[model samples]
Target chain A: MRKLSRSSGDVGKKITETIEAVSEAIEDTLVVSRKFARQDEETLGNAERIIDSVLRRFSRAASGLTESEELLRTENNAINYEISDVFVALQFQDRVSQILALVCDDLNKLEQHLNELKSQQADEGSSRSVNVEQWLEELSKTYTMEEQLTAHDGTKAEIKTDQPGITFF
Target chain B: MAKTILFVEDSASVRQVMNSTLTREGYDVILACDGQDALTRLDGSKIYLIISDVNMPNMDGLTFVKSAKQMPAYKSTPIIMLTTETQEVKMNEGKAADVKAWIVKPFQPAQLLAADSQLIQA
Candidate 1:
């Protein structure tokens, strides 16, 4: 076996830099996604307004055609319902943002830990290793969603749709 | 007159969605970006109900609920927490803060409206 020596400080520094870069990228993505979501909402709002205006004008012009007016009204209601569903789907951005924020926080912490290890290696000629179990426990404590825990445990998380997690006290 | 509801969430998209949904249901909505901003919006207005996100910058939802409950004007107003957080500990904290309902995020607009209808009388 050939022995290839790499300093712990060098390894730690590389890891820290990588983590920091990833965290920054995640943060930037969050900002861009939020901006896009706002723009999407505005565009949807405008479309809804235009549709409503056209529907109202059509109804007024064709007041004598009662059956056609009713059909138009029904179609308008269905469109509005679909728009509402889009809004609900848009909420995925919020959850994704939250999960990414948490990941960013964890990355920052990991970066900090690496930096500390690098400093220790420089000062003491040896790096103190993190306790994997304790670190995992600490990470689990920060999770707020059940999916996070399930993911951490390497289990498939149940995908919840239409089932509202509601509890009244 | 339409009943007023104060909705607080940090995400702009969620705010827009909630505003549209609540307004469409004939409820007047007041939007705030966070708990701190929500506190400022609670300037003695006759809010029929409140919907808040659990985790937010400046102040979290439970803290805001506790502070809001302290106020004489909104002491008895019902609050529904609409958040991604599913931790039981946080829910217990919310209950202690007088939060009437907890609805997890990505919830259907109908579920939220149903909760609103249940909490606030028509």
Candidate 2:
């Protein structure tokens, strides 16, 4: 099949459109995620702290009251169940944080894709014409382009490839 | 001294390029990664304008604008949303959030810098 080429200008506009859409989606996710982070970050951590406080308070109160040993043991057992409940809540919090991380990762990918589009536009602008489908196909074959760095502890050190592969959609 | 402009973007590379270019143009440059972080750094700092990326981790640009607008100190601040997309809905959302301008990404550096100067001088 003959490859159809797009002018640098046209490709620039198309890439801009795609990047804007992805950026907006990321913004939407960011809105929700920020709210979650603000409201939820210390939620589980605070719950655990509160549980400890409650147990301490119960122990102090039981010591003051002239209750039977069995009664005090029953109160302790109830508090243990409550502590278990707090653990369950903490697990939920952890899961929610994980989901937010996934959202952040997707948004980061979108941002990177936008950067690639711009770079491609610049490269095309420099060259005057580019095949969009071929470019995208090549991008699809590669994984994500993440932030990376390489440095040797000493001079004349051999270079090694430590770059992660892109996970294309 | 040139008017100061603050840029809040998450990407390290973008931040570096923007800082270098903006500083070269005689503008005082301050940088932050996200909306909340920007707010933290804004105290005692005189910023004539703000340019922000839409999708950030701790705080998005629009929501940032919404919160910033509510602050009496920054009520008149001219906030611009920089993005790679040009969706109408997103623009409208930004408008409602009181963002002063929306710039689609891959912008020409000349045009972006020119716009910044204009906004700062105005």
Kindly report the fnat of each predicted structure, to 2 decimals.
Answer: 0.80, 0.00
- Please give the distance, in angstroms, between residue A56's alpha carbon in candidate 1 and its true position after superposition: 25
**lDDT winner:** 1
Residue B77 lDDT in candidate 1 = 97
Error of 2 at B3 (Å): 1.6
Q: Please give me the DockQ of candidate 1 compared with the native complex.
A: 0.48
* Candidate 2 CA-lDDT value: 0.66
User: Relative to the true structure, how large is the alpha-carbon lDDT of every model?
Assistant: 0.88, 0.66
Query: Least lDDT summed over 10 consecutive residues: which range in candidate 2 chain B?
Result: B103-112
**Fnat for candidate 2 (0 to 1):** 0.00
Clashing pairs in 2: A19-B84, A20-B84, A20-B85, A143-A166, A143-A167, A144-A166, A144-A167
lDDT of 1 at B16: 88
Q: Per-residue alpha-carbon lDDT of model 1 for B9-103, expressed as tens digits?
A: 89887788779889988999999988999999999979999999989999998889899999999999999998888888898889988889999
